[model samples]
Target: MYTQCPDCRTVFSLDASVLAHARGAVICGNCETLFDALDTLAEQLPPEPFRLLPGHTRSEEAPKLEVAIYRPREDVPVAVAEAPAAPAFTPGFVQDRRAARKLPRRWPWVVTCLSLALLLAAQVAWAKRDVLISDPTIGAWLRQACISLGCRLPLVRDVHRLHLVARDVQAHPSVPGALMISATVRNDAPFTQPYPVVSLTLSDADGHRLAMRRLHPSEYLDDAAVLRAGLAPGASAALLIEVADPGNRAVAFEFGFE
Candidate 1:
């Protein structure tokens, strides 16, 4: 049976026979407050129905039942005299039961740590985005991820490894007042290099600059070339540029990578 303590409002379980033998009087185990269990005992009494009675008539009260209280004889033998009282029935006494608390599971923390590690790894991958995009094997995986994740690929733009191979400026035969320029640049580094920006300087016969033009990668590379594409070691590209004539005095030109 379940019992609730009135003093501390603590609920606990107890045996019915123990409660009956104790005569409905128990000390609260939680608050250490001695209280009459009979005052707050849980009992189910028979219900009485309401009925109309004549004003002059009187109702008889129900007879009460006599209960016998048992006590040991004072002239009992030595064995009976030495017997002890039941501890549960003693006043100011309570039963002590130590209950262990339950602990929460650890899988939640493990999952959180795993999630944080994945986030850190994703950040590192993004930081080295250019290198991954330039690698043929890794680039294929990255491109598939980009397609699935709805993301754009970043460009590779390292230009220090680019070197000018040959260049020349000549007058256009068909177009009046126009000059044609042709140049070849190579990737001289031991590793692959990114597309480069070319700076063209038109000069007079004495090497004094007449005009300058900056050519972006898009303006020079073919439509098949893309930002994620790279130049292999020792690979070269031929560039063709058209410009309005600088003048008859412009006799030479120079090309450089930025």
Candidate 2:
């Protein structure tokens, strides 16, 4: 039997024996609320016309049985330890079956998650060994000896190893006071990729609208063989990025290896 936990909105499967043996009351596993399962089901009652006064029944007429539908109870105890005691719910509070169970605030989990994210990001950034674009420009070089997910997978792509950098930028290069971008891409995928995939996106401060591009190594880099540009295991390269107008540097540049 399937029972919905009004408190948590979770559906739990009930064992056949348990369902069969369940008494009038059923308790929610999540919120620990109790309900009278039978009290909530509507049963046919005598119809208005079918119910007659005790003395008014006429033997001449065919015997009638009352059959009517009724809305179940408007309010059922969230829990009822004893018939005379009030339920767990406060009076006048709107009760929602879905509210029977609720997730914990998760403040600790959230903090832990954010902490882990920062830690991983820090680790990635640390292991990054790439360029950091503080100005408003785009395109910079990033290199890693080799990225390992620390585990094995069917495809190497499953262990995605990529580097990314960003900043607020404009589509057309501005001059003097105008902003412009210069990018250099180098591939370090250990395995020589005849072509290294390259892409860049420029956005505003709010991370709203901007421009992006994806080009082949020949299109995105100074050298044709990106994988050849790959550092020999522990090798590194520096791609200089200078703004024409040092003031409003273009947004930022991003690089990745797969």
Candidate 3:
């Protein structure tokens, strides 16, 4: 009979009497560890092709006993490593970060709104330019703006700012059938103003208009003055008017700045 040590997996030969005496308990010779021999014991059978004959007269033979010691392979113990813990998330911290990122996105819309507001304000100012110029403070502001742009504002058509004086009409001594007329137009405005259009009307005895004429600045201003060289504040200009007499029946005439 054969036995194996459970601790060292070492095999040893033993008599049946020795196993009976130890009662299936023995110490490993190689490892010196105590273990039960019966726990490691295995039972085996003969080969299939060999058998005993039925009626054969043969001398008695001692029984051949064979024992095989089976030692199971040992299992190796493995150590398992634990994984690292993940950080916990907080709702307030996450939301604050998201809000910080979204704040920059609003800037473009803000800039666009401001630009639109400025454009609207400029349009309203241009549309109300006439009304703005009527006030002294706003007029000064507008005049400064015009000066910066190298431009001029058109004169207001306020008849109260002008006066007509020194009016006369006489027959032309050199040109017969024609009349020589003269007048003085004055400006009483506080600021320089553009030349006004002159309107002349001839009336008959029946108070019906016979002839009418309107003269523009370019036509009447034959002096060295250009359109931009407007009349000075509180200044006057002499108008030398000439026209053909309508007839003996024409008795009245009118001249004014339109």
Candidate 4:
């Protein structure tokens, strides 16, 4: 009983009635569209004259009509939106770190490694050259290490005996202290070489080793001709030797310049 509007696609109906005018316009209520009844009806009619009914009444039902449909060249769908399905696995099982605390912790060996490295470095430095012992007390102890090394100084004297000598020992800030003993190596060897070294040994009252030091007269001499100190072959150079521990000792003393 309703007629679909040609312009707005709304369903409307006009009762059977006399149409006096050839052209007229009507507004569609559903879509609020204005359309020409004259042109639209002309296409639907067979070019007939104005029709008048017994009374001026509009039909409750619209007469059967034919209309052509116009469609856009695009695609359209009726539903608004769709959702995707959920996955089987958990959301963050592969890359999450929150669960790491549940695992056991491991020991850190880095502290031990650093300590070992420092020890090794110290050993290397000490091993590079000879040692210097300068203390009179502990000098005896460290003298053992020196004697063990068997190092001797250039001889500037001989028969050249050593008297009361004090050995001093001091530790390097970065390294342990050493014993530095200063004793008298009396000049008794009449003949001398430019590279002369002193030789002697000392012990504690209990015959225990005390402190020892080396005295290289040539090495210590600013006089380049110390090697020429060679007593004209036989003439003796009465030399005076003093003893002092540069490192300072408390009790005993050891002597060995070699």
TM-score of each model, paired residue for residue: 0.48, 0.25, 0.53, 0.22
**lDDT value for model 1:** 0.71
- Candidate 3 lDDT over 1-258, as tens digits, reads 556676666766676777788787888889899877665453432354523212223348966768857869976555323554577777998989998987768788999999999999989977886667656788788888999999987665555677886788888878989987888888876656678888889898899999888888777677755556777667888887778988887788898776
Residues 10-97, model 2: lDDT tens digits: 4445544654577646787778888543333222333555322122222667867688677677776655634556557644434543
RMSD of each: 18.5, 26.5, 27.5, 27.2
lDDT of 3: 0.74
> Please, what is the whole-model Cα lDDT of each candidate in the order they appear?
0.71, 0.43, 0.74, 0.43
Stretches > 4 Å off in candidate 4? 1-195, 238-258
lDDT of 4 by residue, 191-248 (tens): 3323345543445556655544466656444555654444332333322233443333
Best by lDDT: 3
Stretches off by above 4 angstroms in model 1 are: 1-103, 128-154, 189-194, 222-230
lDDT accuracy of residue 69 in candidate 3: 78
Error of 3 at 23 (Å): 78
Q: Report lDDT (Cα) of residue 92, candidate 1.
A: 34
